[model samples]
Target chain A: MTPETARRKMTGTWSAHSPLTDVPAAVDTELAAFFRARHADYDDIDPVVADAVGALELFVTGGGKRLRPVFAWAGLRAALEGGGGSLTAPTGPGDVLRAVSSLEFIQACALIHDDIIDQSDTRRGRPTTHRRFSALHSERGWTGDPARYGESQAILVGDLSFSWADDMFADSGVDAAALTRARQPWRKMRTEVIAGQMLDIALENSGSEDPGAALKVDVYKTAAYTVERPLHLGAALGDADARTVSLLRKVGREIGVAFQLEDDHLGVFGDPAVTGKESGDDLRSGKRTWLLMCALDRADRSDPAAASRLRTGIGAVETDAEIDELRQIIVDSGAAEQNSARVRELTSDAVDTLRSCHLASPFVDELVALAEQLTERRS
Target chain B: MTPETARRKMTGTWSAHSPLTDVPAAVDTELAAFFRARHADYDDIDPVVADAVGALELFVTGGGKRLRPVFAWAGLRAALEGGGGSLTAPTGPGDVLRAVSSLEFIQACALIHDDIIDQSDTRRGRPTTHRRFSALHSERGWTGDPARYGESQAILVGDLSFSWADDMFADSGVDAAALTRARQPWRKMRTEVIAGQMLDIALENSGSEDPGAALKVDVYKTAAYTVERPLHLGAALGDADARTVSLLRKVGREIGVAFQLEDDHLGVFGDPAVTGKESGDDLRSGKRTWLLMCALDRADRSDPAAASRLRTGIGAVETDAEIDELRQIIVDSGAAEQNSARVRELTSDAVDTLRSCHLASPFVDELVALAEQLTERRS
Candidate 1:
């Protein structure tokens, strides 16, 4: 089928409802197939090796929004249907899907390593990889420190995911020329995200109270990696011109920043049942996030004593009462409300950009819905 | 120049001395050039990131035998001048050099992660990456757990190396078809080494007493990744046929095993001044090396009490007297002698295979000399 006709038919199927509903399953299906092939290849080597791969597979298929892939697909669709360029739709949607699925592996790498750094016990309501392996050591009556063993295994597993992510991207069945084009953004994304992560660690280590520091971390760690680069990659795959890539990047950055701001809000105040994370988990870990910075800023300006209490309680092991007090302090300081206002403004700006861009009407609408969903959702 | 004439000139430069002496400088030069470009690219992003990259540079250039790259270059040389094939000398030696240097980055990744796993304080007479960073945290009086912050930085640094390794390989300026061929061994090497590392961890955790278990670890962890796969990668880059690749693999595997066996002996018995490692480090860490397995086996057959004593002494924070006793037991058990004999035998077999193969004469000679240098070394 012609690119336009195929897209039209697909759009028709989604015309009655939101496109976000189908994305998770589609991305999961692609990842599952990839893991099946990996399992077969590795199983032939040794069951032990297969098990390592299996652990990673479980982590990948377990839970995620699959937002990066969705953004990538929308970017490609926008590039193809927007009409002012010679760039055409990818001949094989399967290849694009596989290529985009690599983003999830990158996420897996980040989360696995992040969990270790945070010393987190659970994620998505399941035992973190290191914790799971640590428990295995204890159950099996293994020697050495179980924590060390678990941490080591998790590190290797994270390394494996990183390697496999690259392999998947390279072997995505895209033509060589297109693959080369996609690599610029891909390489930058990997480097920038890691650098961003390093910056976060550095900020936390230094106990910096600078608000600008947190925003820089957010831009590199969340904004570029989660959205801007993925969209740029997709545009590259579609052979989009510079102007189109620039436009998508602007939209992606605003939405990504808004998404992370909402996350910061949820991290402190959302219900554990809904968010799948314990409320105040980030505060407990003493992450130097934008929300924490904003809270500190406001508290310092209005109530010095409240700011002192917040500082003392932020990075410590806190009881339920202390957590509630800190929450109150943040709320009373007006940081939460201000943060929410920024999210709304950024979401609105992203939607406006999407609407004003020369992208296809259907893609623009879907993107607008996605922005709203991201900014407004509890989780 | 013709392939033969180029081979003649290159061989003449090395006729008076060992090839190993020149390899380190050549590989480092290539690596230095690569890092310079990377620094320029990353420095534009953030000085902090530039500093992180700088740390990796220090780690890479600090000290290493550069064995993998040496083996890769030898394999390429053997392929180019081996009489039976249409394969010629690489038109650009610079490309092969850069490609070979990528092995160093992979080694850096392994070392960084291994330091974290082993909780090692120093390597090659310097503090390990994690320890270095941890010390930095203390010096700076950073908040939170200094150890965690250091470890987190090291993990990201390792990740950066892994990513950069792939980028270097892809951009090595080799023809794309040759690179595609090289990638097969490259991918397998990465996966197998990680699997081998996991096996080592499992064996340590399970407290496996079986000598064969350690040997299996050595084969996968050391032999394949360090030698066989690197040679295969080089041969592939040279477009060598399957028979030549197989020959190199066989030669590499035997020599690689010998290399690790020697390393194990050095870990326990060699003078700290010579080995640059505190003697008994492997024992202290309870690494499941073949030497330890052999010692246990011999001790079990002759003296059960000695075996028991050896078991107790291993994996403990021992006094100097205990370490001395352990050394005596290892020597008295005849395990150390037997292990040395095995190394000699393996090295001989590797040389025999290299001589029998229809490879270039000078390269074969160098390979034989390298095997001797690897196995007969004191450290």
Candidate 2:
């Protein structure tokens, strides 16, 4: 994503609501109330746990686009909306609402667990839980290995939240059949999120040390979990026929790839202030993104020594000059341009799928707009 | 615990089931088929994951007391059994059976996650998932770090199992109101188990670092999570009133302490081969169990230098003669006998709670018996 892509000042968001105006507020209210209820006496918990869980409460309720929850409601509504022949629900909204809310919890669990595994120190400008706890452990001179203990505690916190999220969604109003139907995508969401996480880790770790494994990591790690599953889940609930589901997955394929492309672009070119991330952070970490993948391919034919330099911590803070060198290598290899074209092609293909669905529903336009904007977002 | 405790095994394992001995076989058939159907494609999965998942299928189907499920079934029967000498069930046995099977899944989730958090490499002589994956990680040149990736995957796998377990029970038809009542305790069970996991971590990490925080960790971690929550969940499903729930918690208090005490004792005195653990590992690890707490208290008064020596892990994995000297110091401190006596008092008190409940159900005896056996077992 370049500054040119960020030029759309009135950039619109796509949501499942029949009219986009009402979606954000409704999602906020529903999700805020759900958090309020779960943490009604949040401070009254065991003192040791109170502070940590409170931090989580703040992280969740702080703010986001509410895209995940909106997709859930829209998906459910899309499924049952026509069954009632209006932009209203046919079934009681309790179970679906609970189910949708549970995804937010799922998101929270993932973020926490992800932070711990990544050894990331801050999230959304606050210290990560393991870092926070390890700091506390140091101050206290805790008995066992502080780092290991901190990691263990973080693991428990993540696991606890994971279980609570499921229990919350197990509402009685959702009949067995509806639940069983709904659970297929639900199953994939869990499995794929985890699979994607593995790939992300593998690509970072594997280097010229093992190039083949790193590429596979990119597919399973990012493309499938983050975008593909979320869209499929929405379609599944929207009463999609097999054709519609297939198209939706294709839509996911394009958006998911482009989403990663935009991410990689932002990693190098975007402003740290706007992204609320340090500049060159991914480069410092030596991530094997799509841009890197293409560069490696080009280097296999030419400039093998240059590719070797790109394999190690060429992006580390200590190697400041290497950042520019690394960026140039990516661009000069023609990998950057190739991936840029791929992004455009995928986004165009996704738009075609939306058109071919041929539904007269006015929401189709917004979906198409979303796919286009998604690939082009600067941050 | 000693062989004297394990030797007094209660003999009438299935005597009470003579009236309907057919029930066990029926339950076994249903459960076995469930595993076979669910895991029919086990051979097709990654050998390691296939083995991890397959282990659960085998273990669940393998004989344990099945005491938890049996209690659930009996309670459902007792609650719904015909009141006026009718032969037909007030509720179908299948309904109770399904609910009971769900409880088994919950138990499995607890055991698997516990093994990961505890870093225990084996369960009943088989390698744990982390250990298996740790070994596999060594074989594969997985990109950055395979053990970290493996642990994360194991956590996710446990999470998947836990969610699936909750789903199995979510739609179980024990009547809408009954499920509604079960919801609170069931929800609490999830929360408490997590809180307890935190407490366990805290206790293990406490050492002599933070004296003030140590005591609270002891009370909240094991006592509340392990002993208390399981009983509460069982009683809630059995339709126990608030007074009974409170009573059950008190029973948990007594039993949980004894359970931990017995655990500490086994960690010391139990044979390595029979217990499937190296004896005195706690002492070697410098774990601050109650026995160690008692020893420290004694040494502080009688011989200051001895306390320091004990804390240093002086004889931890040392020559046998050095270990004997350390063992003698612990004996001179009289920590073992004191902790054992406490276990005796608490175990007796836990049994007394059942006696006074006056429920006059066979479940009361079995539960009491289970508690006693758990606290007394040598291996």
Candidate 3:
């Protein structure tokens, strides 16, 4: 079938301001086929390779909100239809789906490596990559240190995922010129995420409590990497003009920050059952989230004793009582209410920017809906 | 200047059977410029990022044989001129230099990550990437474990290098179509090298005594990764035909194995001053090199006592006396002689294959010279 008809059929399921559910489903389908083929290739090389790829496949297709791919899809539609371009000979929806699906591999590489760096034992409630490999080493009664073997294999696996992400994108069957265009943002995204990671460790080690420092981390680690760049990459793929790209980035930045704020809020206040993680873990770890910074700042100005108590509590709180006490202090200092208000304001500003811009229809509407879903969700 | 004229000038310094000194020098120059620009870009982001990139710059430009880039250059030359392609409108020599220089970044990533895996303290007589960062952490009196901080930073730096390698190759100013053509082998090469690394670690941990298994490690770890794929990538970049690419890979695989065998030989016997490392270090570490396998195989067949002695000595030798005795046992068992003979046979066979093939010229001669230098070098 022609690309236009395929696109029409694909979009038929969507209604005004509805979630772009088809994008995530399409991305997952593409990833499944991609991994199956990769599995065969790795098996050809060695069973050891196949094992590594299998772990990566599970981590990639296992669970994700597919946020990056959704944004990329919206950006493409925004450019081809919203940016006043006729839908003449647009890149095929299938090809776009395949290309954006490659983003999941990038996410896989990032999280796998990040877990090793953070010593995070679990992700999405499953054993993190290194931990999984460590368990394998123990189960098989392998020689040498199991932890060392696990970390080493995880490093290689992460490296493999990073390489595969590039290969998958390049071979996503997009036109050569369009692929070249998309490469600009794709390349920048990889570097930014890694650099952001470096910044994170540095911040932790330096004991920097500056909220600005934490926000800078969020801008690079989340705002640009998660939202702005994904949109830019899709826009580039669609051959969108510079103005539209800039506006989308601005909108993306706001939405991304709001999404991150909501996540930080959940890390502190959300239900453990709903989020699938213990709330206050961030407080116990003394992660320099913006929410914590806000709380500290407000309490320091208004009530020095409470601020001191909060400071001592971070990275030291163990019992539920201590965590609850810290949570009360944040709420009493008005930081919790402020954080929620900020999320709402950011979402509103992003929608305002989208509405003011001359960007095309259904995409602008879809992005607004995505923004709400991301920032307003409880868990 | 025009590409043909530039090519003539570049090749003017070469003499038949002489080292391609120009290739390494050219690659280093390109890498120097590349890193300088990347350094600035990172600086623009944040000081922490700038610091990370600085460390990568030092490690990447520090030292190595630049073997991969040289082979890639030879392969490209072979395909363009030796594969009977006319000199008309060849890729600019400068662009080719920049493109091949990207391989050093891959090598950098491999060695940096490998050092972390091996817990190696030094590389090329300098602190390894992780150690360098670890030193910085201690000197700065950073919080948390210095070792963890160092390893985490190194992982990110290695990741950055890997990402930069792709960007450098993609933006090498090569024609878009040729870039697309190069992507196939380039993608495969990345996967193969990482997979090869996985195989290497598995072999070490499995405690397998089979020489065939050792040979399999050499094939993937050394032959395909270090040699065959570099040549294939270069040939693909030059748009060489399938037959020519196949012939080049055959030559590459043979030469690659011989080079690795030479390295193994040097690791055990070459002078520390010459090879810049302690002899028998590999033996002390009990690395499963082909030479070790050969020693075990022959000793097991004829002299069970000698084989047992060798087995017990590995991973346990500490004093100089123990290492000397083990080396003596290897030499007396004739495994050392067998290894040297195999290296010679492999080199001879590779040259013969090149001579028998109907592939293009000057490159054939140049590759033969490279094979001799690689396999016959004392260090």
Winner by DockQ: 3
Instruction: Kindly indicate the candidate among 2 and 3 with the higher lDDT.
Output: 3
List fnat per candidate, in order.
0.79, 0.51, 0.88
DockQ of each: 0.69, 0.38, 0.83
Q: B87-179, model 3: which lDDT tens digit per residue?
A: 224456567667888999988899899999999998877888899889988998888899999999999899999999998998888778778
Docking class of 1: medium
What's model 3's overall lDDT?
0.83
Interface RMSD (Å), every candidate: 1.0, 3.3, 0.8
Give the Cα RMSD of candidate 2: 7.0
Off by over 4 Å in 3: A1-19, A84-91, B1-19, B86-90
**Which lDDT tens digits does candidate 2 get at residues A1-379?**
1232223212432223433334445444555666576666433556556645665566666666555555555445444433222222443444454456566667777787788777888887777776777777888888657777767767766776776566656552454445555666776666556555645554454444343454344444455555566556655655555655665566776777677777777787668877776677678776667677678778757888777767654545345576778778778778778878978898888778767664445566766666677688867
Give per-residue CA lDDT, model 1, range B1-379, as digits (tens): 3344345445653221225446666677778888999998887666668778988999998868898888887767766768233333343666776788899999999999999998888887789898888888899898778888889999999999999898888888776677777878898898888888988889888888888878878888999999999888888887777789999999889999999999999888888778777778777767778888889889999999999999887988467788889889999999999999999899988888778878877778777888898889987
Full ranking by TM-score: 3, 1, 2
Pairs that collide in candidate 3 are A82-A360, B82-B360
What is the C-alpha lDDT profile of model 2 across B5-120, one tens digit per residue?
A: 22222231222122122344544555675666556633342343345556567555555545445444433333322211111234344554555566566666666667776777
Point out the higher-scoring one by DockQ: 1 or 2.
1
Candidate 3 interface RMSD, angstroms, 1 decimal: 0.8
Cα-based TM-score, every candidate: 0.91, 0.78, 0.94
